[model samples]
Target: MPEFNAPLRDMRFVLHQVFQGPALWARLPALAGTVDADTADAILEEAAKITGQLLAPLNRSGDEQGVTFAAGEVRTPDGFKQAWQTFREGGWVGLAGNPEHGGMGMPKMLAVQFEEMLYAANCSFSLYSALSAGCCLAIDAHASEALKAIYLPQLYSGQWGGTMCLTEPHAGTDLGIIRSKAEPYADGSYRVSGTKIFITGGEQDLTENIIHLVLAKLPDAPAGPKGISLFLVPKYLVNADGSLGERNAASCGSLEHKMGIKASATCVMNFDGATGYLVGEPNKGLAAMFTMMNYERLSIGIQGIGCAEASYQNAARYARDRLQSRAPTGAQAREKPADPIIVHPDVRRMLLTMRALTEGGRAFATYVGLQLDTAKYAEDPDERDAAQRLVALLTPVAKAFFTDTGLESCVLGQQVFGGHGYIREWGQEQLVRDVRIAQIYEGTNGIQALDLLGRKVVADGGQSLKLFAAQIRSFCASEPPYADAVLHALGQLESLSQWLGERASSDANAIGAASVEYLQLFGYVAYAYMWSRMAAVAKAQRKQEPDFHDAKLGTAAFYFERLLPRILSLEASIRAGSSSLFQLSAEQF
Candidate 1:
């Protein structure tokens, strides 16, 4: 079996040396005294232990046994319930939750590292906690005080699990067409009747109760998405005194047998006249749900990074130990029958590509986490607004780009093992199977790309893209390592943004036609910016930690030399416009 040890040193480098997370935390009053470098390190270490020791052992077994459903009850695989108890006891579910609600109140900058570790150790196990965290975030952001007081504590404590129920059989991406209905009652609650599909952890044996955030349309509302509303519906109703009352009408009809992450119960949740309280205003449910979706989008992106990291570790180790053929020039291991595959140029290319993308993605995810912290905790209004805008602009890229390259890296890692990678015991195949879903879920990568190009970039007339470009330009002014290359990439992005804006004005289908490529181009440039920053930091600190920092410098060079140029072809594809795409009609196929 493959092994997973949290890359603590690299994580520390990103958190401390590359991003200076502690200094930024100190600047934000909400996070000033909450955590420091030592505290963050301790938290990360504990998280590593729990994930690497407890959860990782269950990853392969969990995938094999999967979840079982009987008599309308969903049971997780063996050892998961015990692991959940330990995980909850550690208060990890609410690592970044609000302090007032019994949470530890850690900044996202730190919580992101823990999340990566969770998914790396076990993606299936990680989804349970990830959903709960996202559900808590949405409720805390938009729920009433009474609702928060009643639900937040239990959800944060992990006594109860949480899920976001948005997709229905008839509605997946176009939520406006959903048929779920919410009927108002005299007692100020609504009777929610909806059949939501693909609900993660909707009905699980790991927790006492499951809190579901459902989306439905009210009776007297306008048509389309404006008619939608968000409701807090639980599996078991809670009495005024906070004890569990009779079972609500919500029940799991069945669990979807999926290709990967099989341990996670992808449930068909049937809410039959379930008692639900409105969260936030009616006709604004999508807005409230976006609070959770954005969080999940980023979380799913980390899922990609986690899987890639795990795959890279196993592949790198396997290459070093598995001897295949003698080196072209000479045998480095004369005592052995043949030199290790690591001596081969092709193997080196695959391993280096994996390392470069995984490390660059880590830096990029951390950067987004820092923006989340700044957006929420910054004292200055202008600063907070800027950070929030950056969050909006970069989120889709983070989601799509990370997963796109994440899958690429995993495939490369699998290829490193040749036929062994195709088998189940080695665990490379599992990583590939598990990470594939990241690209499909959380508003498929295609939707994410269109969101980036149509909504975030072109919708704003390139203003948001310019805001990002300005930051890169500001960094380029300092002339750090790879600054010239980064600046040139930034220029290409700017020119492309302008070109896209012009095309969008002239052609309605231009954005959709070019969205996926546009997002890929943006992703490459964004990672280039991250690699540039990491290179500068590693170059300056190479004397202190030669092995670590030198490796970073080497990877940064690899990214700039090999991966960064992918944007050139993406740029050309975007410039090609929608004409070729439209040439084929619906009848052509």
Candidate 2:
């Protein structure tokens, strides 16, 4: 089993040092009574325990057993159903949801920690909860009041699960090509008819009811994404008394056998004239579904961070304990048969690199989560707007960088285990396989890059980029002990941003082609800012606990010396964008 002790410590540093959760919580009325340093700490401790004890024990078993479909029902791997029951019983489903709708109203900063822990423990089990949270968030924000009243509590409590149905056989990222149709009925209901593919947790007997947020076009709707609308199509319709009524026409046609995260139960769903009610409005579903998609993007990034941290722990431990070769330097443990692998420079490099990236990724995710919270809960419009821009700018980075690093780190971990990693039992190979999907799902990293460059950056005239750049500058200008390194990293980011801004001016395709690489550069720089701030704070509190503060300084130095230098490579890619990206004609294939 993977140990999560270091991860928990890093989570605390991110929440308190990077984002300053306590101070921010003080400003929001919604978080007044529920969150504080102590409360947040308590939540982290409990979450760590649950993830390390309950979830980690089953991660391998779940991966090995996966879920079996028999006679129209899906049987999740052993202990998953029970784990899910406990997840619901603990009110975890609503951790970042609306309190009025029976959600815990916990801020996203706090909620993101759970998201990472779930990824660390078992990405498969985490899917059921993650989907429910996102589904309810969209519903709470855009669904009818009646729908909110009926479904929010159950969904938040985990009595029910939710699924996002957007992709079909003909359409994946190109929703404009989707063929799902909605036909109106007399009782203000609609019949949803289509088949949705790659729907995670789409069909399972884990809960009493499953709520599906389906996308379909109306009879007289316009063509393309604009014509799409979201619908609340439950497997079993809820009565006025909140009890299950007749089963809707929707059914799971089959399950997808995927490369990884197999316990998630991806389904091929067939909606045979399923009775459904519109979520927000007709011919406006795609816009509304973006709400869920955006949330999922960030959540997926958290998955990457957790998996990387888990991999780092396993690899670090293996390197420290495994003794095979003598130390490069004079060995302190000379009495032993051979020095541990940790004594090797390259092995130490890998472990520290994993640590630096994983920790930086955690800080980046929490910072984004905090901005999201402020965007929704801040009293001032200016503050809210500022936070919103950061959210939009950093979201793609969070999704792409964290997951990309996650895959890299997991692979490095597997390499550390040598031949044993190729086998599943040592657990290194499973982590690699499990984290791979984070890069592919919730919109491919390539598509997300396009969204960033085309929509958020160039199309917006680099307004979001400017706002974030200004934020980084403000931090760099501060009188921190390590101001030189922080300023250097921040300056690199600014230069990269400038280079991107210039290249994207005339070339429309540049944004799409350069988006992923730029987004990663953006993430590294932003995390550098965070690490600098954290180290400064830790230094200020040197009298309190030098270990924590010293760790912050060391990690910040590691980021500056090692990770922050990657911006030069990414900048080149962004600058080279559109030329090579567009060079390939259809015949090039």
Candidate 3:
């Protein structure tokens, strides 16, 4: 694999030029004096160094060897233990976690960039830290003070890892159908007994202890998702003095041999009279679990984007150096055997597509991160509400579209390398395998789409879409440099969304049928608007910095000219309806 670059210039462009993340950081009273442009720059530099220098080299080896399980113990791949130690010691895991819980309390805008770096360098190693922070967030928000005092520091410090156990053999998207059971004990704890499959970081030797935030149905609980309760299940029982006690009854029943991310431990955990603590209110577990799931969904999308980034770099580098056929116009490199493969127009098309998406996806990720930060930390209720709604609406798109584009981009990257990309030698192939999980896990991209078209768009009567459209319209009306392209793109989005939101009510399955394509349409148009917005800023301020502005303009042009046409296809699909779903007889093929 090529040495990973920080993409520092692009990161800076998104932060200072696009979001003015520093100013937003300054606005928060708690972060007023703690953050500045210089400090932020240093953090990025340090994070990038950690990712490239420490983690990048281990990616391939991790994927090949994965986690080895024997008897009751698990072992992480070679160099992973050291890399994990470096990651934890650097406090990267809790960048956005509570400062009170031994975290840096950085905003999502900053933390999300670091996440991209981790994911870009090596997703397998990144999963350990990501899941830990997610567990920390859940514990901080809902767990008792005693539980927080005991677990937060360990998780934040990376001395222990965490997992969220919600899926079982029969339950994933439909959690109401889960069969896990949690029976209360006299000492106020619960004895949880059940099986949880596809639990990431479930049992690993990377950390000393593993904490699982488990979902189970209490004996006295009501029916459906409403009756599901959340429990805190630890691999080792904690002594009264906060020391690790003997190992608990829970253990990994088996490890799944998945299509990708082979190194990251995905386990089927079996609980047999396991001692657990209640974290949140009974029957309110789904809401509590979503706090972690929402964060994971975005990160999973970035996981896809990161793999795309790694693959693109490898492929682009290979294209520039590899000699294949002669240049089309003439025998370029006449003194040598052949010209570089990049001379081909179709190759250029693939590379440019990869570049446009990987970069555009980064910007989109930052935009969503900004919304999440504002939603939680914004003081005013209205701002918070608006931001929250936007996050809800865009999240499914971010998860589905970003990953879809990411996978497509990686595939193109692989195609650029031809046979070399498919083979194991170039390391580009690893990127493809590692990223495949992002689409399947984290509630699946299909589930994400359903959430968007059904719950987010139509359920709220298109209020969120209107709120987002206002931003597009405001910038389009006043920002002339972006006026024409953005206005056109936004108009298409508004028209489609308006119709989908209306039609969804009349047909119950309309949203589901249209969701995946609708998300793609939204993503393309949204990226078109973003590219234009960045180009507008670039044009006004950076006349001398043509390198940056030109790139933005080129990407914007590519989006509008090439990618935006997909809306026509999606519009057609959205209109396809349940002719295929319910139209056929029960046994039809």
Winning candidate number (TM-score): 1
Query: lDDT score of model 2?
Result: 0.85
What is the per-residue lDDT of model 1 for residues 1-589, given as tens digits with 9 covering 90 to 100?
Answer: 8778999999999999889999999888888889999999999999989989999999999999999999999999999999999999999999999999988999998888898999899999999999999999999999999999999999999999999999999899999999999999999999999899999999999999999999999998899999999999999999999999999999999999999999999999999999999999999999999999999999999999999999999999999999998999899999999999999999999999999989988999999999999999999999999999999999999999889988999999999999999999999999999999999999999999999999999888888888888999898899999999999998898899888899888899899989999899898899899999999998998899999888998888988998899989999898998899878789997
Q: Per-prediction count of colliding residue pairs? A: 0, 2, 0
Measured with C-alpha atoms, the lDDT of residue 533 in candidate 1 is: 94
Candidate 1 off by > 4 Å: none
**Descending-TM-score candidate ranking:** 1, 3, 2
Most accurate candidate by lDDT:
1
| Local distance difference test scores for all models | 0.94, 0.85, 0.85
Q: Give all TM-scores, in the order shown.
A: 0.99, 0.96, 0.97
Report the alpha-carbon TM-score of model 1 versus the true structure: 0.99
Query: Candidate 1 clashing pairs?
Result: none
